[model samples]
Target chain A: MAGKTPAGSARSDAVRNRRLLLDAAAEAFAEGGVEVSIGEIAQRAGVGKGTVFRHFVSKDELLAAIMLGMLDELIDTASGLTTADDPGAALKGFLTAGVQIFVRDRAFCEVIGRPSLQHAEVRAAIDRLCDVAEQLTARARDRGLVRPGITGTDVALLMAGVQQTAAPLLAAEPQAWRRYLDLVFDGITASTGRELPYPPPSHLSLA
Target chain B: MAGKTPAGSARSDAVRNRRLLLDAAAEAFAEGGVEVSIGEIAQRAGVGKGTVFRHFVSKDELLAAIMLGMLDELIDTASGLTTADDPGAALKGFLTAGVQIFVRDRAFCEVIGRPSLQHAEVRAAIDRLCDVAEQLTARARDRGLVRPGITGTDVALLMAGVQQTAAPLLAAEPQAWRRYLDLVFDGITASTGRELPYPPPSHLSLA
Candidate 1:
């Protein structure tokens, strides 16, 4: 109680306000893209416009923070996955969860890929994702669940393909993306584990 | 032969000049992206700047014409496929060729997605593409080469994914896209012919 002075209370209050602002900003941006106004985000967080600026200097900065937050969530999800038993299943599960995050958070999906946000922090976040993917993929390959020569970059690109391809389909047929994901997973799995749905390209031995 | 007057010679010269300009423009745009200047294109085609404007009117107009030309080429290729017996193979071949076209022509890829270029003519060219895809997809479905419930839009979306993902990879590894396309194709093939690599998503039966 002696250490809980006025300064301590103010710092705690600032921390709480920051969390509230981030949550409100995420919701606002998800609903109304990255172009959502600072005033709207402040109002949603039950704070003044100045408070929003106090936490985030600009909209781009706010969007970047949101992106970093999402990446952290994805990284945590990947890290928490238990893959010692079935590495393939773990990889698929992580990719599924990641794609779902992209689906639920359109603002994160849109803003992260913009030319302006390709800074070091964002790149580092993406590299962290690739690191997790590489770990999962390596385990799967060792277990003979995944095809040989399949790199983490391949897995990452396939998951990105699913997210990017599934964006428009969300409006008309919400679940159509699941079909494509199934295809991609099956394609990448070792031929011995699952029968290929078709022959590989004639010139290349995909197996 | 009597009709080969000076006016006729001039008309033939104009026609030859137009063809030369288009070929030059295509080469310049493919090499230099959408930002390539009209003067550069004209110089490449061995014509004066005035001649380039006389044919294309503007850079956008030139780009549109190039797009239309590519669409015509695609439509012709699709129409020529002998799909009466092996529709699935035909469909796959058409998609593979289409992706190759996008890879070879960066300007076409860059301009196709621009909001401003979504005019009636461009829309018509795109619709023509969809029409061919639908025809091929329908044939494949009848033959049961592709999985059930795979629509023409799905085929189109997959091709777009190939084009989109392959764009960046082209700079590093030209043939890298073939790997993803192989995965996609194998995934979509009938399970009766090829085994699935993994269990389909639990929520949906991917038959």
Candidate 2:
């Protein structure tokens, strides 16, 4: 029993330290981008450099983990909205939550085209996110709210587009993304009977 | 007469070399981004390293020159479109030309937020571009083609948004941007009578 107590305490400490590193790293990266050094992240975590290495094998691994966390949160948000009473509003709610993540986390946006996306876990999570987006979009389409031929992939791409469009002014006008989002939302939902010029992207693969 | 001929020949050679350097540098930066070395640009231009240094003191200067050229071309395109038969088509034409440049030049997009934008010439050129965009947009607004309060800056930002949204898939789907452009164009022109969520940005200063 005495031996087990020490082992259990050590395991809990590892878990706590891991959480601290992730939170600190996320904040540092969000503020400074992925270029924020692991050393800086350790200092921010109030832990030794060796501790960061123990948890994340490399900077890319740490980034992949962070991206996974973000994707999962988005997935959960989309999943929750799938059965909401208003299909259009549900999709908008999901997009608002997703773009909010990009708005707050500069590193997440910077890392989208980086090699970390090639990580298997990150790829799987993105695929899952697309799945949920499709479900939400389909719900709206069925209600005749979204335009015909609009796909979840199109919605997903447009969400990222909204962030990109508002990125330049995010510092000066943090709520600027809302404007672009509304424009894109109106674009998808206006039911003008005009077809999108291109076929929907069949899949979501940023890697 | 003999001395004048020699000097005239030297001046013409310099002019030709400058043109060559600009073309080579533009192509290199478009393909490899701003990280392409001056030596590589000189090599592509078939000029010596000293020739590149003589024409442009630094890489940023070289990049500024390329950007100015691009901006001037866009300005010309926009200027010519102000009197086009259709106001909406003119704005869309301007956006199409602008986005096509972004699609072709990776460095132009990369340098938008970089220090080079702080260069006085680049800043002036961007302001000029915004002015022309304003002219086209105001024409559309007066004709009730564009939604109320949709400023040229809004149109400008959305053009960039379309590029950013399609950037990730550009390699596999070169024309994907056209689809996003159509979506955004539809957004600005739909006239569904919905007010944009936020006021338009007043000016363009990527610096």
Candidate 3:
């Protein structure tokens, strides 16, 4: 049991180290964007750079991991809203949660166009996010809450658009995104019976 | 006249070279964003690298010049729309022209957050653009064509937002931004009388 105790303790230490690294990396990147270095992240986590390298190979790898976690959280948020009683409110809730992530994490917004977005796992997670968004959008469509011809991809694109548009003003007006989100929501939910000038993109291609 | 001819020829030649450089730089940057090098732009312009440096001190200066041109064009377009017969359609036309510039010029979209945006002349041009946009919005609001509380700054941001949202898919669908523009236009025009959740950003600060 003495030998087994040493092994178990090492495993727990590794698990704790990884968790700390992720949290510290997230905070550092959120504040400084993708340019935050691994050394800085390690220092912030109170660990050595070796610990960070052991957990993640490169900065891109670390960013992809962080993005994957964010995607999972958003996916879960969207999933929960799937059973919401009011479809419009549910869709709005999902967008609110999604944009809030963008607002809080500058790295997430900055990384959208970076090469790390091409990472296989990150791409798959984005695909899953789109699918869940589709479910919510479809629910709203069926209830006639959103206008005709609006697709999940449109909603997904608009969600990011709101973030990009508000990004320049985020420092000055942190809640500015809410106004754009409301504007977009009103746009999508508009019942004026107007048709979008173009069809939705056939698929989600973040890269 | 013969003595002045050589000096005049050199002056004319310089003007022609500057025009060629600007046109070539615009095309190159539009194709490759701000990363397109001055040497490449010179090559595209059929000139020496020295020619680019002589005309513009740095890439940021060149980009600011290009942005100044675009802002001037947009300001002119908005100015024309202010007195149009249909205020709503006029505002839509302004958005269409504005988003089209973003769709065609990738550098324009990419440079929105770069240091070039901080250039004094470019910042003043942007201010003038916001003022003209406000005029258009006010014209529409007075006629009750657009909802209350919509500002020119709001329109300006949403125009950029549509372009950002459609950027990833532009390679596959170049006209995709029209749909987003339509959606946003509908949102601003929705007569459903929903008030925005936040006030208009008090001022525009693109940096």
Candidate 3, residues A159-202: lDDT per residue as tens digits? 77898778667778889999999988999999986678788887
Error of 2 at B156 (Å): 0.8
Docking class of 2: acceptable
- Most accurate candidate by TM-score: 2
With candidate 3 superimposed using the best TM-score fit, by how many Å does residue B139's alpha carbon deviate from the native? 1.0
TM-scores computed on chain B for all candidates:
0.80, 0.90, 0.90
Q: Which is better, 2 or 3, measured by DockQ?
A: 3
Off by over 4 Å in 1: A1-17, A31-53, A57-59, A111-116, A190-207, B1-73, B82-89, B101-127, B140-145, B166-171, B190-207
For the record, the alpha-carbon RMSD of candidate 3 to the native fold, in angstroms, is: 5.3
Each prediction's whole-model lDDT (CA): 0.68, 0.80, 0.81
lDDT of 2 by residue, B77-113 (tens): 9999999999989999999999999888978876654
Better of 1 and 2 by TM-score: 2
Candidate 3: clashing pairs of residues: none
A1-207, model 2: which lDDT tens digit per residue?
101123334678887888799899989988887779999999999999998878777787887888788888899989999999999999999889988888888787766543334577877777788789999999999989988888887787777678878776766777889999998888888767778778777675454
Q: Cα miss at A90, model 1 (Å)?
A: 1.7
Q: After aligning candidate 2 to the native by TM-score, how far in Å is the CA of A109 from where it should be?
A: 1.6
Q: For model 2, what is the alpha-carbon lDDT of residue B63?
A: 86
Which model is ahead, 1 or 3, in terms of TM-score? 3
Off by over 4 Å in 2: A1-16, A47-51, A113-117, A204-207, B1-17, B37-52, B113-117, B204-207
